[model samples]
Target: MTFLWRISETNADGLIGTYSRSNGLDRFELRRGKRIEVNEAMPTVRFDGRTRDLLAFDCLSNTAAPLVSQRMAQALRDSCAQDVQLVPARIEAADGVLDGWSLLNATATVRAINHRKSVYTMVPGTQAIMSFRHLEYLEGCLGEHQLARDAEYLGHLLVSDSLAQALSDFAGASFERPEEAYYETMSRRWNSANDAR
Candidate 1:
């Protein structure tokens, strides 16, 4: 299966934003004040042996560096507020050099909106702003052992040196902001991928 990851960046008052994509539709939201921005994407894919939906989120907030870090940790805890236990896990970047980041693993039966079992990871980034990436793969995609393997793979990709370099270039560029650059990059990548098809 093909995994197409969409990217977005936002800069606004209160520093809250959301980006959601499902079934070829995309929605974005932003709010003001001390709030947590939840960016969710539900992409369906065939993994393991069955078709499944993967729910992903990138939660970010803007504040003093210290507060941002604090909020990031708190947000991670809040994500698994239900009957779920989070275990500290190691995620190595493919190209090495994973600075100021940590990953947490958990498996839970989410019963609030839908009754489904899921395996998820909470990745907190302690950069200029506090940011957290939450990724959940439905039960079928990951069994007991697969969870660790998949999580590690994802972690490595997230912290890869190549990814870091690209992001750094995006940040240093005078393209208004990283979010705009990210959108453009994703759009270009998507267009190229579709063109080849």
Candidate 2:
């Protein structure tokens, strides 16, 4: 999807050129919704401020096709000398065990615990409070699991490098799993409850 970035506003000193800055005072009063169409080429870079930074008078539109990520990497490299790499992945199936939230909740709980204990060592006096706060972010996942009683769940899908690493490491950690049948039933009930809404 193409993202359009229109100029909102700029510094009063005119360091950055925006829509209003480009226009000059004219004799004829230009009311709102006045048809200001361009018959010829428009002014490009107007260096008004001390910094002499190039600013535009009007909005610029750009279009792109599907090879967006590749183009983005090339643009970044062109702008700066930095190495860019991308990793892609796909899930073949859900394994027919856990519904979405069942697996996600388990994963998030494990992660929050590890983060609270290993990554960030909170003082015992504050550990309980911090842990609760951290767990709150995972509420959606927990609620989802509670709703999807018995369906097999699979997620923690890898979208980015950092997320993939976090999920893989989190999965390596352990948690107490209920008996298979009980877990399935609970998951189904929870999923049904949520779906009703």
Predicted model with the maximum TM-score:
1
In candidate 2, what are the lDDT values of residues 76-193, reduced to their tens digit? 2343222212111111111221111100111111121223322223447653322111111122223322111111111111112222232222211111222232355557888999
State residue 55's C-alpha deviation in candidate 1, in Å.
28
Task: TM-score for candidate 2, please give it.
Answer: 0.15
| Local accuracy of candidate 1 as per-residue lDDT tens digits, 150-193 | 23232111111222232332211111222343455567888999
Error of 2 at 151 (Å): 60
Q: lDDT for model 2, on a 0 to 1 scale? A: 0.22
lDDT of 1 at 148: 21
RMSD of 2: 24.3
- Each model's lDDT: 0.25, 0.22
